[model samples]
Target chain A: MQAKQIDYAKEKRKSTLGWAVAILLACFWLVLTLTPFVFMVLNSFRKQFDMLQQGVFHMPDPWYFNNYVEVVTHGFFGYFFRSVLVVAVSLVLMLIIASFAAYPLARMKFRFCGLIYAGIVAMMSVPMHVTLIPIFKLTTDMGIYDSLKSLVGPYVAFALPMSVFILTAFMKTIPKEIEESAEIDGCGRFRNFFMIILPLSKSGLSTLAIYNGVAMWNEFAFANTFLQTPSHKTLPLALNQFKGEHALDIPIILSVLTLSVLPMIILFVIFQDKLVKGMMAGAVKG
Target chain B: MASKTENKSSLAKVRGKRVAVAATVFLLPTFLLIAVYFIYPVIDTFVISTYKWNGISATRTFIGLQNWVNLVKDKNFWDAFKHNVVIMVFSILLQIPIGMLLATFLDAGGRKFNIFKIIWFLPYLMSSVAIAFLFTYALATNGGIFSSLASLIQGKKVTVDLLGRSPHALFAVIGVMAWQYTPFYMVYFIAGYGNIDTTIYEAAIIDGATRGQYVRQIAIPLLGPIFKTACTMSLIGSLKYFDLIWNLTQGGPVNSTELMATYMYKLSFQQFNMGYGSCVAAGMFILITVIALLFQKAFVVKEDY
Candidate 1:
């Protein structure tokens, strides 16, 4: 009986240890994932003096809100809108171009579809550094080099390769019979493409659209290259300005970080399920 | 009426080729864009690699394989290449085990897994730029989170300026990368686990396979495709890695962290050595292409008709 009691106690201890282990792992992961954002948000609320004394953890005693106030009045809001416009225009153009390209590869029989797909995937592997000089040179030659139009053009081009593949893969799941029946009607090829193919491709288009949207929204390299003018700079590029060449302001810096992430967070919360699923799915293979 | 229609159909059949031609016309717009944007750029890059020119000065002299020769000799190119190799190895080593375990552990936890899944993936999606911003504080020397932890663990106030030093710089960079991408692999592992037919587990259990053995044999094999694909994708991503490292280190602390892509960028645009840069670009393109093809052949299986 004494032996039995010892075994029982040992089993209980084992189970308890298991729970502890699980909780510990969970806490470790939670701290890693959440703390940075929590730190950013907390630091954004603190005054500059308080920010330096603490490394973003000390609670602001007065709960200063001046960071947001400063960001708003500083005309960074205009910079934010510029980011929106660029991302939006780029997103729409990419979808249109990718779909236009993808529909043929998916539905219509093309001899070089594999080659085309390979070319696109191969391009993804090509370092952006490789194309930077030529693209810039090309942009300058095109006369809209520093303008938003020039920026949008290469974006649509770069985005086309992957986005088209994604759409084409998705298009494979679409019933070909619909296109056949549409073809039998008086509808011409162009009309069928626009009316039938485009209509049926909504989910695929949206998924690709969100990928481009977020990418363009956060795009740094090209914007840094093409849009050197303060008026032309997007949010990511503009955020770089908060810190001068050498000097740094911790509170304002934190505020910029907070502001950069806020739109994405809001977007995540709003379309949490769809956005996460779509983005992850897109990320995996695309 | 049917007979007359048939006669008319033969005449219309001649026009059917015209219709096919018109149908092909719909594809022209997109095809042209791809040719210009993707196909042309590659051709242009290859052509540019042969010519010696500083981007702006308007003189292009033909130089045969000189840039390629220079890249092979350049210590900077080698350093960048080695840096990427380190990233690739660490990517495989760090991501696979941690991701696999987290995925498996979270799987057994069931409903609890949902919250943790979201929590883990949240960091993966956090902007590379933003994470760089935050970790600057987290890993700093003066009572920084990492520094504080080091003090507590070692029972002495330890100091390491991770960013400033070469010893820890690459590790620190990979640590952030692991923090970000581990979730990416976990998602695949969890999904792969879920798809395993239930009877296989029962058979393994009846045969007296332990949990560890079962995971090693069954789960790993089944998750192989995902592992292979992720490995290749992440490797390619590692080879051309920019943004995160760029945002994090900027190939900094005396060029200790430069990858091939970042170096190529600096050479091409920053220094205006367009000739040598495109050669490096072509080199990268060839290397990536060869690897991708080898990967496709070796790992990613396609059903041959």
Candidate 2:
């Protein structure tokens, strides 16, 4: 009876401490995480002079909504559409291609499979920046310089390694019995993979599709460098131009940053679970 | 694991080959794209690195490894390398361990793990530009919260030029990198920790082993492969870290925080030296690949933990 009483006291103490510490840590994280958004949100309501002259700690005195209106007038919607165009097309192509590529590597017992696998892994390690010049030259040479075609091809190339790696690993987890049975049942190898293996690998494909889609959407470097014209530009590059023109305007800057991240924030808030699960599946590599 | 998964008869195996052929045929689009876009550019990067051309000058002068030879004596190249070494050390020293600790905290959070996990890993999923912008506000020396805290705690006006100094700037950037990525790494380690055998841990406790001993002896040894994978990724990541620093400071204030990748960017885009830029890119590519490959070979447990 004495031992039981002591155990109860200990449990109560643990509970109190856990709640207290967890709340404290969570608060600290929340503040740090929200600082940028807070600053952006606050500045979006301030006038230009009130921003740089006064400290960032200054409250949004006399809150104004003019900057956000200005952003819409500056062609943010076009930028948004172009971003969607790039992300959607690139992802669909990557998925179809990666599915086909993963099949041969995972299922077919081809000669020199080890060599091919290692070669692909090496290709993965080679930085895309190394070929920036050649690619730019080639894109211009092929006369697809500022078009969507230029974006699609290289994006597929760079993202292929990881997608293939994930799909291949996911493929390995699938048991051989189903494939063997399907073949015995007179279904062709192609049909076996398409009907049986493909269904099983939905998690991997979904993971790749979402992550790659988000990345292609957020891409700024290649988009800015390769596609120079305003009409061909994506969202991030468009916002970056806002930065260049309005180097000192805090409200405009804040609005642009918000405009850039708003879509991702919305998607994440909704589909956060699927994203994490997919990330884990792709990253674990175990 | 199945014996019957093997083909029963040679006649049946021939049919499998036909199916395999169809699958391979379907894979042609991907293979052809990879060859043209990926495989070609890399080979071309090497060839271009040996030439002296101003991108669109229409004349490619054969320089024959002059770029590599020049890079050998380049002070900026060495500086970038040194900076990356500092980044790699700081990232491993701070981020990896913090990630491990956070993973433990998240694991021990009981019913709150799901909520805390989402909150923590939120930054990882955000794009580099977004995070970099946020961190710039948070870490900015002037009126930044971090500086404000420093002043409040130390009871004085603390003015740290976080983006303008040498050692301080590098550490500040590294600090942000660590803070931003700890959660991503935390989840991976958490997954690794979940796979640890609870039965062994229980037995260890029953045998009078302390929690420290159990973790050190059992957990670490068991987690060897995952730990190695994490380290390999961080090492490569630190070396190739471009976007975060690029967005925050753009390798500015006299190249104090310049990395190989960022420096390569500067050379190619800002300086317009196609030759020098490719050289740096090639050098970084080789360095990262070699280190990662060597680490994998050294520490990867081929079969199982």
Candidate 3:
């Protein structure tokens, strides 16, 4: 009995030691993660030349707000609103088309069901760079180059494969009997989809919306390639524009970076659980 | 009886035709968009690779296989590809293990450690462009975070030239990539841990297993499929990495950090070498597809629940 007591004490000591190590490592990573953010935020409040004079960790001498004020007044919201507009249009179109394609693949009996589903799923691994040159040519040829309309097609198209794959999987879980009962009331496939399946897939649709929304909002390659005019650029390109305008003023550029990232952080904070759950939904393989 | 059977067969035919029509209408838009954006562009990239024309030119010469030959011999292209492989290997190595460790910590500590999860996930909320710009300033030589910390430690002002040097630039970029993406894998493993049945933990404990033993033996083993998926994702992500590197360095300082995507972007967009850039882009696509398929075949992760 005394030996057993000793073993228990030994195990408790070992577990406590393990916990201590884990906590220490966690705190170390926390510092590593927050230091850059602190640098960005802290330096953004300093005058342009003051960043060089003071230590990085030191507080801003006078806490200047003019950088932010300059950034906002210099068409920051134009870029912000354009991004919002493009993402909204592309998202709505992507969701509707993805759900439409997913419905038949999930519920209906079709001739090329397996082949079609496999083809769409395969496109997920095709890197966007492969299509960059051709899309650029196509955009210019169509006379929509450097316009917001050019972004819509590619955004909707690229998002379709993953969205369809996930939504199809989500729809498969929905019981078949719900659709059958609606069909028995003399409803056609179109009505059955609109009235029964579409409503039931709300949670799945919202998850896709969140997932694809984040992606389209932060998209850079296509935006950088297609949009050249400053007026047509999205939020992701705002940093470049600001940097170009103020080549040496680091504070103004940092303020622009902070502003661009602010909306996403705000959205994440308000929809924390939903956003996490949405990511989980996307993570599950079909 | 014969008349009734005839009538039912004709009705069934009509229903089948209607079903086909419904399916067609439903799938048409998706297929059309994909054809324009994905399928046609992929085919067009290969075709354009065969020609020698600037992107804006209205005419072109059929260069045939010359571009392909040049790409095969081009030292810069191969160097960029080698950089891509390095990033892929390191990303899989660093991000997965560290992320798993973080997730395991959270799983062990449970609800009280939710704050850690929140803080760890903040990096991922910032876009790649934002991260690149933030780190550009954070790692700068003068008054940067690293230099400041070093000066404090050594009791003297020290400048750290991370992004400007040759050998150090790629690794610095890799470290930044890890900083940006580790949170993703952490959350991924957290979800994986959440998927494990609680009964297994209870069973292990009943069998006199410690919490550490339970995680090491039962939980980690069960996360095999998830671990493979995470690795595959990191591999593909690293190969096609563009946005952060583009914004951060533009593959600069003697082409040390040049990746396939950045190289192709520079050729096609910056230099207007459309034909050669198309070849490079096509080459990258082929390599990624082949590697991903081979990895899938090799791993063959079975969901044996």
Candidate 4:
């Protein structure tokens, strides 16, 4: 009976110490994570004089919004729209191609299936940046240089291995009985893939879309290299322009940076679960 | 009967042919894109690296192995590579450990700590370019947070040139990288920890295990494979880090923060030495591929704990 009585006082004491330590660590990391963003937002409202004379910790007297107005008037929306277009087009192309290729490798019996899968997996280890010079030359020779076409082709190509890998892994988990039943209904291979397999793999496709969308949206290296025209430049390149033109104007630069950053943070907030799941799925499956 | 057998066999052959046709039809587009954009570029880069050519001109001068030899002796290349190595080491040291610690706390701390998990993960969601701009301003010596903090601590006006000084510039870059990327591993580890059976933790607790003891003894041992994967991911990511460094420093202060990617860009695009830049690209390819394969062989192959 005495043993059955738990030591509640002792347990409470132990847990209180644990809770204290955990809360302390969590608060420390939270502040560290949010501090820069807070500073950026705060500085975005102040004028150049206030930023220079007062300091980083200064509160804006009038909460000036002119920095954002300047950023918008400087043609930031074009870059934003161009980025959206590139990401959307690249995702559609990547998904269709990757799904088509993935369906056969996952379900069908082919002699070369293993070799093809291995090749795609091995391709992941090859850094695409290593082929920068050649890609630049090749695109120029193809007369697609300094255009969005250059970004689309390579973006879709490099994203294929991972996309195909994830889709194939997801497709493999789908039961074969569903397909066999469809086949027994006089459905051809292509019809069965579109009618049966595609609908069932919504999770995988969405995951790929988000994963590839985020990646393509932030792609700077290829875009920076291929795009030379001012109008053709993406958001990242346009934002980086401020470093040279408005180096001293911290408020304007911060406003531009905030504009580019908010969409991603909002997307992530809306689809946090899907994004996390997609990333984990990619890493684990790979 | 003979006619029936022949028709049956012919039907089987036709089905097999259709399957082949379908596979080819499905794979053709992806393969063509990969060939034109990925495979061809790699081969062309290797071929071009052996010769001397400016990017634009029609004339190409073939000088065998000269670019390769020059790349091996290039001080800037070595400096860039060493910086990559430093970033890699620092990332593995700080990012993984901090991620693991935070994951452990969130897992063990129960639902009350769940909100902090999301808050800490905010950085990982934004683009590296945005993150770079934010930190670049925050760490700016002129009226920046770091300078303000330094002044506050010193009881006088002081400025900390975190990204403008040698050696410190690379460390500052690494710190920003960790600040942005550690949440990735944290989320990753949280998922991994969620996969662990709670009964094991219960068993440990029943055996009178402390929280620290449970993490060290129970958690780490079970999370070995995940840990290895995280290390590989961090290593490979660090090796090719470009976007943040490009916006942050552009390999400034006498090439202190020069990474392989930034250096390669400077050589090819800015300097217009396509051949030498291709050589650097080739070197990067070799290093990335070798390190990845070697790391896999060393750590990932052993599945059994």
Off by over 4 Å in 2: A1-30, A52-55, A184-186, B1-13, B16-20, B135-143, B147-159, B196-220, B297-305
> Model 4 Cα displacement at B28 (Å)?
1.5
Give a tens-digit lDDT track for model 3, residues A1-286: 3333344455557689887888999999998888888899999999989998888789998999999999999999999999999999999999999999999999887688899999998888889999999999999999999999999999999999999998999999999998898888898888899998999999989878877898999999999999999999999999999999999899999999888888887887777666666656656562
TM-score of each: 0.85, 0.87, 0.95, 0.93
Clashing pairs for model 3 are none
Q: Which candidate is the best by DockQ?
A: 4
Point out the higher-scoring one by TM-score: 1 or 3. 3
Clashing residue pairs found in predicted model 1: none
Tell me the docking grade of candidate 2. Answer: acceptable
The alpha-carbon lDDT assigned to residue B268 of candidate 2 equals 83
Q: What is candidate 2's lDDT per residue for B1-305, written digit by digit as tens?
A: 22364555665577567755775686688778768877777678788789876676777789998999998998988898899989998888887787786676654444445776666666665667766776666566766666766776899878656777767788888877876788777877777776666667667756766545666798767876667777877888888888788888888778888888889888887877787787888888778878777767766555445
Error of 3 at B212 (Å): 1.6
Q: What is the lDDT of candidate 1?
A: 0.73
- Which segments of model 3 are wrong by more than 4 Å? A1-14, B1-14, B301-305
Ranking by TM-score: 3, 4, 2, 1
Better of 2 and 3 by lDDT: 3
Ranking by DockQ: 4, 3, 2, 1
B1-305 in candidate 3: lDDT tens per residue? 12368779788777768777888899999889889889999999999999997888899889899999999999999999999999999999999999999999887777678889888988998889999999888999987788888889999988989999999999999999999999999988888887787767766766788878987899988888789889888989999999999999999889999999999999999999899999999999999999998888777745433
* Of 2 and 4, the candidate ranking higher by lDDT: 4
Worst 10 residues of 4 chain B by lDDT: B1-10
Worst 10-residue lDDT window, candidate 1 chain A = A1-10
Evaluate residue A168 in candidate 2 and report its C-alpha lDDT on the 0 to 100 scale.
Answer: 81
